[model samples]
Target chain A: MKKRCWRILAVVFWLLLWQTAAMAVNQRILLVSPLETLQALFSLLQTAAFYQSVAGSLLRILAGFFAGLVLGVGLAALAKIYMPLREMLFPVMSAVKATPVASFVILALIWIPSKNLSIFMAFLMVLPLIYSNFLEGLNRADAQLLEMAKVFRMSAFNRIRGIYWPAAFPYLLTAMRLSLGMCWKAGIAAEVIAQPKNSIGSALHRAKVFFSTPELFAWTLAIILLSVTLEKCMLHLVNRLGRGLENAR
Target chain B: MRVERLCKAFEGKPVLTDCSFSFPTGETTAVLGPSGRGKTTLVKLMLGLLRPDAGTIDPEGAKTFAAVFQEDRLMEHLSARKNLRLAVSTPDQQISEALTALGLPARDETPVSQYSGGMRRRVAIARAVLADADVLILDEPFKGLDPAAREVAANFILSHCPRAVRILVTHDGAEKSLMQVKNVLDLGMAKEA
Candidate 1:
C-alpha cells in the first residue's frame, strides 16, 4: 500500500512539473496546463454528443475485435489440423501483415463509409496478430500430452478442454492484450482521418484546426482513460477465465 | 496377440529387427529390459501412436485402450476424477471406490499437478484401470513409486483389472513378481536383438 502511494505521488509530481512548464510558457496554443485540460474534459462530459461518441466507437471497435478473435481462433484450429489450409492462408496472412494500417484505411474508404471504416481498420490490425499467435500456440502444444490423450481415446471436447485450452491460454491472452490495444489505436487513427461526426477523433481534429490545445489534450486524455479502462477490464476477464478453468479442474 | 516379422529402423539403424511375440490375453505380461531397448517403442506400436517401420500389432479382439506412459501424461489443470471421467463413462461411486482403493481419497478433487510422483502414478494407474479399455498398456507405470507404495498401487491394479489383457513394460524385475506374471519377455535378448 505504501509503495502504491509513493508511485502515485511520483506520477503526481511529474504531472505538476508538466503543469508548471505549460504555465511558464503562457501559450495556450503550445501547451495546455493539466487544470485547463481537466476543465475542458469536465465540460465535454456534460454533453450527450460526448457520450454517444464514446459509445459508438467503443461498440464498433469491440465488434471488430470479437469478430477477429473468433475467426482467427477458428482458422488457426483448422490450419493446425490440416496443413493444406495453412498453406492456402500463407499469402493472405503475409499480405495482411505487410499492408500498412493507414493504407488499408484509405483503400477501405473507397468501399466503405467513413462511419464504419474504423471497424475495418481495427479488424485488419488485430486479425493477423491473433491468428498467428494462436497458430504458434497450437504448434507448440505438448506432443506428449496429445499422445496420452490419443492412447486414452479422450473425446474431442475433453481433449480441447484438458489439453488444448491450457496449452494455448497464455498465448491467447497475450494476443488478446496486444490486439485490444492495436484496435483502439488504429480505430481512433481511422476515425481521425475519416473525420466521423461526434467522435473523440473528430473532436481532436477540430481542436487541432482551431488551436484549442486544452481541448485536444482533454480528448487525448479521454482516449487514454478509455484505453486503460478497456485493457484493465479485458485483463480482469481473462484472469477470471483462467481461474474458472483452474477451479473446473 | 501377435506381431509377425516386426522390424523398425530409425535413420538406417535397426531397433527391432524381425521381432515376433505372442502376448498373452486376459493376463499381465511384464516386458523387462534395460534403457533404450525399444520398450517404449514397443508400447507405441501396440497402441498405434507410432507406426512401426514393418509390423502389425494384431490385438485380436481389442477395441479400446488405456495406457500409463513412461511420462505421467496428465492434464495439469484438471482433477484426477475429471481425468478418469474423460477416459471412461464410469459412475461417480465406481470412480470414488477406484480412487479409494489406490489410497487416493483426496485425489478426486485435487489437480494432478499438486500430486507427488507416487500419487500421480497411482492416479495414472487408476485412470487406466477405470477407463473403458479392452487392453491396458503400462509403460514403466511404477517407475517412481517406493516399494510399499508400489505394492499398494499394484494391489489395486491386481484387484480392479482381473480380465483385461495387461501389458506391463518396466525395468524392475520385482514389479513382474508383484504382478504374478508367468511369462517375462526380455526384449534385449530377442533373437534379432
Candidate 2:
C-alpha cells in the first residue's frame, strides 16, 4: 500500500512538472501537458483507426517475435547435435548480432513491402540473442543425466521434454525477455522508417508532421504501455510452461 | 554376457587391459574393486558411453540397458514420481511400491533438489529399479544411506529386479550375500598395462 501510494505521488509530480513546462512554453505545438496528452490518448482510443493501428503493429511485431523464436530454437538444436553445424552458424549469428537494426530495416524496405519491414527487422534483431542463450543452456545440461538417457534409449521427444526443457527453461525465459523488448523497439523503428499504414510509428510520424505534440506524446505513452503489458503476459505464460515441464515426462 | 579380453585407456594411461568376465542371465555379479580400478570405466563401456580400445563386449543374452551411475543423476527440480516417470513406463502402483520399499516419498511434492543426500540417492535407486530393462547396473546406489537404510534399499532392488541380470558395484562385500550375489570379480587384482 505504501509503495502504491508513493508511485501515485511520483506520477502526479511528473504530471505537474509537465503542465508547468507546457504553460511556460505557451505553444501547444512545442510542448503538451500531461493532462493534454492523456485527454488526447482517451479521445484517440474511441476511433476505429486508432484500434486498427495498434492491432496491426502488435500482430506484425508478435509474428516476427514468434518466427525468430522458432528459427532460433530449431537452429540451436541442430547446432547442438552437430559440431560442424555450430561452426557454420557462428559467423552468421555474430554478424546478425553486430549489425544495427537500422541497416536491416533500410535493406528490408528495399526488398519487401513497407508493411512487412517491421516483421523482418524484428526477426533479425531477436534471432541471435535467442540462439546464443538457448545454446548456452543446452551446453550446460547435466552430462550424467544425458548418460542416463542414453542407457535407457529414451525417445527423442521424451529426452527434450523431460531433460532438455527443464534444463533450458531458465535460459529460454531470459532470452524471451530480452528478445521481446528488442523486437518491439526494432519493430517500431522499422515502422517509423517505412511509414506503413495502420501502425503506431506512422501515427507518430503524422503527429510530428501536423505539429500535434499531445498526439505524439499519446502515441509514445501507448507504445510503453503495450510493450510492458505484452512482456508481462509473455513472462507469465513462460513460467506456467516451466511448471508443466517440472513434472512432465 | 561376455567381456572378452576387454581393454580401455584414457589418454595413454591404461585403466583396464585383458580383463575378461562373463555375466550369465538371471544371476548377480558383484564387481569388487578399489578406487581407480576402472570399475566405472567398465560400466561406461557396457553402457556404450565409452568404447573399449581393444576387446569385444558381446551382450549376448542381456545387455546392461539400465544403471545407477556413480553420480545420482536425478533431475533436481522434480519429485521422486516425476523423476521415475521420465525413466520408466512403469505403472503408478509399481512406482509407488518401489518407492515404499526404498523408504522414499512416493508422491511428495518436494523437488529432489531440496531433499537430503540420502533421499536423492533413494530416488535414483527407485528410478533404476523401475526402469524396464533386462540388466541392472547399480554403482554405489546406496552410498549415502546408513546400514539400516541400505538393507531396505538392497532388499527392494533384489526383489524388484529379480529377473534381470544384476551387477552390484560397491565397497561392501557384505552386500554380496544380502543380494545373493555369489559371483564376484575383483578388478583391483586385474592386470593393466
lDDT top scorer: 2
Per-residue lDDT over B1-193 for candidate 1, one digit per residue giving the tens place of the 0 to 100 score: 7777778777888777776887777688888777777887788888888788886788888888888888888888788888778766788889988888878874457788998988888888888888757788888888889999889888888787777778899777798888877677788888445
With a 3 Å backbone cut-off (N, CA, C), the pairs that clash in candidate 1 are none
Q: How well is candidate 1 docked (DockQ)?
A: 0.73
**Cα lDDT of model 2 by residue, B1-193, tens digit:** 7799999999999998888999867788989888988899888888789999999888886744899887888877777887887778889999888887888877787888898999888888888878857888988777888889888888888877778878888888667777788688899877532
User: Residue pairs in steric clash, candidate 2?
Assistant: none
Q: DockQ for all models, in order? A: 0.73, 0.68
Q: Tell me the spans in candidate 1 whose CA falls farther than 4 Å from its real position.
A: A1-6, A242-249, B106-108, B191-193
Regions more than 4 Å wrong, model 2: A1-28, A245-249, B191-193
- Model 1, position B60: C-alpha lDDT score: 84
Tell me the TM-score of model 1: 0.95
Query: Which residue window of length 10 is worst by lDDT in model 1 chain A?
Result: A240-249
Q: Count the backbone clashes (under 3 Å) in each candidate.
A: 0, 0
lDDT of 2 at A79: 95
Chain B alone, TM-score, model 2: 0.94
TM-score, cand. 2 vs. native: 0.91
